[model samples]
Target: MIWNTLQLALREIRRNLLRSFLTILGIVIGVAAVITMVTLGNGATKSISDQVSSLGSNLLMVRPGQRMGPGGSAGAPMFKIADVQAIAAQVSGVKAVAPETRKSASVVVGSRNWSTVATGGTRDYFTAAGWTLSSGRIFTEAEERGGKAVCVIGSTIQRELFGGGDPLGEMMRVADFSCQVIGVLASKGQSAFGSDQDDVVIMPIRTVQRRLTGNQDVRTILVSADDGVSTDTVKARVEKLLRERRKIGENEDDNFNVLDTKQIAQALSSTTRVMTTLLGAVAAVSLLVGGIGIMNIMLVSVTERTREIGIRLAIGALEHEVLLQFLIEAVVLSSLGGLVGVALATGASLGLSSLMNIPYLFNPGINVMSFGISALIGVVFGFFPARRAARLDPIDALRHE
Candidate 1:
C-alpha cells in the first residue's frame, strides 16, 4: 500500500516537473541565504578574535585621551615618558610596559621609497604585543638607551621595499635619519577593522622622539598583565596609580583611559553574532513562503487528481493512504530543494569568503538544521491539503470530474 502511494506521488511530480521545481524554489533560496550568512558571520567573528589575541590575550593599552576604539583617541594631552616608568614601577600585576609613540614617515632605501606608519617603543613592546621576528634580532637594551638608528620592518614593508630579499642589516632612510633594519616581523595580515597590520616600521622610542616626531610626548602605553592576572585588576591598579601620580582631584574624571584588548574582542564578536542571527532570521522568512507554496500546490494537485482519488477510493483504498501519499510528495519536494540549497550555499560561501578575504567555516549543525526545517515545513504545510483530499466524497469527486 505504501509502495503504491509512493509510486503515485513520484508519478505526479514527474508529470509536472516545471511546476514542482517552481514550488520548491523558495525553499532553495531561503536555505541558501541562511547558511551563507551564518557561515560568513562565524568566520568573521573568528578572524576578529584571532587578530585581537595576536595583540596578546592579556594586553592593556593605556592612553592619555579617552579612546573611542582601538588605536583611537579624541584630542587629549600626551603621556610623558615618566608616566611609562611610573606605571611599570607602581603596577604590580604587570608583566611589562612599553611606551608607544608613532608618526607617518617616508622611508627611502636606494631607489625604493615607501611611506608607512613608523612607531617607537622599547624592546618590551615585542613581548607585550606577542610579536615574533621573522628574521634578525630584537633591539638591544643599549640600542634603545642610546637612541641608535636601528629599526624593525613588517612583512608588507619588506615585500614593498626589498621585494622578498633579505632585509637584515640593510640601511633604510627614515625621514631625516638613515636607520638599519635589524629585524623583519612575521606577517600579521589585516586587523579586524580592515587596516593593514603588516605595513609598519618600528624603532626605539627615543629614536622616533628625536627624529620622527621631534617630541617627548608619548601617544600610548602598552601594558601586558602577568599570566593568571585579570586585566580588570591591572586596569584598576593602573588607573588608581595614574590618578594619584597625575594629581587629579577626587571629584574630577580620569584624564587617562585604560583599554583591555580582550574586552574589545568580545564586544565585537558578540555584535557580529547578533547581526548574524538577525540576518539569518530575515532569510528564514523565505522558508515560510516556500511552505505556503507547497500547501498551495498540494491543494491544486488534489483538485487535478480528484478523478484518480475517486477511483482509488472506490477500489477499497483507505483514507489514510491517500493522505500519506500527498504528504510524502510534499516532503520529498522540500527535502530535494534543501539538498540543492546546501550545495549552492557551500559554493557561494566559499567564493564570497575568498573575495572578501574572510575565513570559510563549515558548520554541520546549521546545514542539518536547515535541512530538517525544510522537511518540517513540508509536513506542516502539506498536512492540511492531504486531509482535505482524504475527506473528499468519492461519489461527488468522481461525478464532478
Candidate 2:
C-alpha cells in the first residue's frame, strides 16, 4: 500500500514541477549553508591543533617579565644569561637550555639588502626549539665565546638571497658587521596564524650583544624537559632557582615568568571547540527555515487536491492511504533537496578554503549526520499537513468548488 501511495505521490509532484522546485529551494540553500560553515570551522580547528602539537608536547618557555600576557615575552622583562646557566645546572628534568636575544637588522648579500630579524644564541638553540640544520653546521662553543662573525640562515632567508645556490661559505653583512654563512635551517613552513616561521638568521649570543645590539642581557630562554619528566615540576624548580639567584625577597613577586607551551595549546584547543559548536548552532537555524517551507507547501498541496481526496474517499480509498501518499511526497522532496545540497556544500567549502588559505578536509561523520537530519526534518514538519488531508470530510470536500 505504501509503495502504491509513493507512485501516486510522485506522479502528482511531476504534474506541478515548477511549484515543487520553488518549494524545495529553501531546503537546498539551508542545508548547503550549514554544511559549508561547519566543514570550514572543523578543518581550521584541526589544522591549528596539529601545528601546536608539532612544536613539542613537553616544552617550557621562560620569558623575562614582571607579569605575563598573551604576547609572551613582549610583556615580560629581559631575562639574563645567568638565569639560563642556572636552569641548565640546577633544574632537574631539564634536558637542554638555550638563552636567546633577538634584534632586527638589515642583511646585505653583496649589494642586495633586506631587513630581517636575527637571533643570537648557542648551538643548543636549534635543539631546544626542535629545529634542525639542513646544511653546514651550527656555531661551536669556541665561536660563541670568541664572538666569531659566523651566521646561519633560515630557509626563507636562504631562498630570498641565494635563490637555489648554496648559502654555505657565502658572506652576509648584518648591522655593519660581515659574517660567514655557515648553515641553513630546514623549512618549517608557515604557522597556523599564517606567519612564516623560517624567515630569519641566527648568530652567536656574544656576537649579537657585542657587535649588533651591544647588550649583555638576553631576552628569553627556551627549555626542553627530559623524557618522562613532568613540565610542572621543571617550571617550579626553575622559578625557585631564579628567585634565589636574583636575591628577591620571598614576599615580593619575582621578576620572571615561566610558561609551558603544552598548557597553552590545551587551553586554546578547548576554546576553539566551543567556538565551532556555536557557529554550527547558528547555521542550524537555516535548517528550521527549510522545514517550515516544506510544511507551508504541503498545506497548500492538501487544499488544492481536496476534490481529488473526496473522489478517492467516495470510491473506497482508506484514510491511512491518503496519509501515506502525502507523507511520502514530503520525504521525497526533502531527501532530493538534501542530496543536492550536500554536493553544493562540498564544492563551495573546498573552493573557499583554498582561496582563504585554510585547510579543506571533509569529515564523513558530520556529512552523514547532516543528511539524515535533513530527512528527519521533512517527516516532522510534513506530518501535520498530511494528517489534515487524511482527516478531511468527503461530503464537504465534494461540495466545495
Candidate 3:
C-alpha cells in the first residue's frame, strides 16, 4: 500500500516538475539566508572575543579623562604622571604600571621619511602589553632616566622603513630628535577596534614628554595585576587612592577613568548576542513566508488533481494512504530544497567572507537546525492539503473534474 502511494506521488511530481520546483524555491532561499547570516554573526563574535583575550586576560587601562557632561564636554581636570606613581605604590595586587605619552611624529632615516605614531613609556610597558622583541633588547633603566633618544620600531615600521636590512642599531630621526631603533617588536596584527596595531613606534617616556609634548605629565597608564587578583577589587582600591591623593571631595566625581578590557569584552558580547537573536527572529519571518507559499501550492495541487484523487479513492486506496502520499511528496520536495540550500549557503558564506575580509565559520549545529525546521515546515503546511485530498468524495470529485 505504501509502495503504491509512493509511486503515485512520484508520478504526480514528475508530471508537474516546473510547479514543484517553483514551490520549493521559496524554502530554499529562506533556509540559506538564515544559516548564512547566523554563521557569519557567530564568526564575528568569536573573532572579537579572541582579539580581546589576546591583550592579556588581566589588563586594565587608566586614562586622563573626566566624565563627559550632557554636551560631551569635560567637567573635571585631567590626571597627571603623579597619579601613575601613586597607583603603582599604593594599590595592592598590582604587578606593574607604565605611564604613557603619545605623539604623531615624522620618522626620518637619512633621506627616507615616514610619519608614524610614537608611544613613550617605561620598560614595564613592553611586558604589560604582552610585547616581545624580535631583535636587540629593551631600554635599560639608565636610558629611561637620562631621557636617551632611543626608540623601538614595530613590525610594520620595520618592514616599511628598513626593508630587508636590520633596523636594530640603526638611527632614525623622529620629529626633531634622532633615536636609534634598539628593538623590533613582533607583529600584533590589528586590534578589535580596527586600528593597525603594528604601525606605531615605542620610545622612553621621558623622550616623548620632553621632546614632543613639552609636558611633565603622562596622558595614560597601562596596568597589569597579579594572576589571582580580581579586576574590580584593584579598580576600587586605585580609585580610592587617587581620590585621596588628588584631594577630591566625597561628592565630586572622579577625574580619571579606570577601564578593564575584560569587562568591556563581556559587555560587548552581551550586546552582540542580543543583536544576533533579534536579527535571527527577523530572518525567521522569511521562513514563515516560505511555509505559507508551500501551503498555497499544496492546496492548488489538491484542487488540480481532484479527479486523480477520486479515482484512487474508488480503488483499493484508503483515506490514510491518500493523506500519507501527499505528505510524503511535500516532505521529499522540502528536504531536497533544504539540502540544496545548505550547499548554496556554504559557498555563499565563504565567498562573502573573503570579499568582506570577515572570518568564516561553518556551524554544523545551525545547519542541522535549519534542515530540521525546513522539514517541520513541510509537515505543518502540507497537512491541510493532504487532508482535503484524502476526504474527497469520489462521485462528486469525478463528476466535477
Candidate 4:
C-alpha cells in the first residue's frame, strides 16, 4: 500500500515537471548559499591559524608601544640590545630572544633594483622568527660581532634581483653601502595580513644600525618560549622585567605591549565563526520561503484534482491514503531539490576556494542536517493542503467543475 501510494505521488509530480522544478527553486538556492558561505568561512579560519603558526610556536612579540599601529609607540623609548640580553638571562621557560630593527630601502643588483624591507638581527632571529635558509649559511660569529656588510635575502628578493641565478656569493648595494649575499631564505609565502613574507633582506643588527638607519635603537624583540611552556606566563614575566628596567611606577601605565600569536589566532578564528553563523542564518530565510511555495502549489494541485479526489472517496479509497499521497509528493520535491543543491555547492566551494587561495573543507554533517531540514519542511507545510483535500465532502467535490 505504501509503495503504491509513493508511485502515485511520483506520477502526479511527473505530470507537472516544469511546475515542480520551479516550486523547489527556492530550496535549491537557499541550501547552496548556506553551504557555500560556511565552507568558505571554515577555509578562512584554517588559513588564519596556519599563518599565525608559521610565525613560530609559543611566540611573543614585545614592542615598545602602548598600542599597535603607525604612531602607537610615539613618545615611547626604544628598547636596546641590553633588554634582549636581560630577557634571555632572566626569563624562565625562554628558548631564544632576538633583537630586531627594520629599514625600508632600495637594493641594487647590477641593472635590477627592488624596493624592500631590510631587517637587522642576530642569528637567534632565525630561531625566534621560525626562519630557515634554503641555501648558504647565517651570519658567522665574526661577521655578527664586527657588523660586516653581509646579508641573507628572502625568496622574493632573490627572484626579483637574481632571477634563476644563484644569489650566494653575490654582492648587492643596499642604501649607501655594499653588502655580499651569504644566504637565501626559504619561502614563507604570504602572511595572514596579506603581505608578502618573502620580500625582505636580513643582515646583522649592527649592520643595519650602522649602514642604514645610523641608530642604536631596537624596534622590536621576538621571544620564543620552550616547548610545553605557557606563553602567557612568559609574556607576564617579560612585562614585569621590562617595567622594572624602564622604571615604570606601580600606578603608571605600561610603556610596552606584548602580543601572543596564539591569542591572535583564537580571536581571528572566533570572529570568522561568528560571521559564518550570521551568513548561514541569513541564507536560511529562503528555506522558509521555499516551504511556503510548496504549500501554495500543493493547494493549487488539490483544487485542480478535486474531481479525481471525489471519485476516489466515492470508490471506497480511505481519506488517509489520499493525504499520504500528497504529502509524499511534497517530500519528494523538496528532497530532490536538496540533492541538487548539494551537488551545486560542491562545485561552487571548490572553485571559490581555489580563487580565494584558501582550503576547501567539506562538512558532511551540515549537508545531512540541511537535507533533513528540507524533508521536514515538506511535512510541515504540505500537511495543511493535504488535510484540506482529505476533509472535502465527496458530494461537494464532485459537484465542483
Tens digits of per-residue lDDT for model 4, 254-340 = 988999999889988999999989988987887778888889988998998899889888997789998998899888888888888
In terms of TM-score, the best-performing candidate is 4
Per-residue alpha-carbon lDDT of candidate 1 for residues 1-401, written as tens digits (9 for 90 to 100): 77888898888789899998998898899889889999998988888888888777699988886555554555566799899999898889899999999999899888999999999989998888777899998899999999999999999999999998999999999888899999999888888778998998999999999987889989889999999999999999999998898888999887778989988899989999999999899889977887898899889988988888898889977899989988989988899889888998999999999997889999999999999999999899999999988998999878865
Candidate rank order under lDDT = 4, 1, 2, 3
Q: Comparing 2 and 4 by lDDT, which wins?
A: 4
Which segments of candidate 3 are over 4 A away from where they belong?
A: 1-16, 68-75, 110-112, 354-358, 399-401
State TM-scores per candidate: 0.94, 0.91, 0.91, 0.96
How good is model 2 by TM-score? 0.91
Best candidate, lDDT: 4
What is the lDDT of every predicted structure here?
Answer: 0.89, 0.83, 0.83, 0.91
Q: How large an RMSD does model 4 have? A: 1.6
For residues 1-401, what per-residue lDDT tens digits would candidate 2 score against the true structure? 77788898889889889888877787778778888888888777777776666565577877766656645445445777877887898898988899888899989887677789989998888888777889999998899989899999988888788885898999998989899999998887766556777888999999999988888879778888898999889889888888887677979776777888887677766777787778777777887898899999999988988998898889988898888888888888887778888898899999998886668989777677778877887799889998998999999878767
TM-score of 3: 0.91
State in Å the error of residue 111, model 1: 2.4
Better of 3 and 4 by lDDT: 4
Q: Write one digit per residue (lDDT tens) for candidate 3, span 279-324.
A: 7777678877888888899999989889888888888578899999
Q: After superposition, how far is residue 32 of candidate 1 from its true place, in Å?
A: 1.8
Name the better of 1 and 2 by TM-score: 1
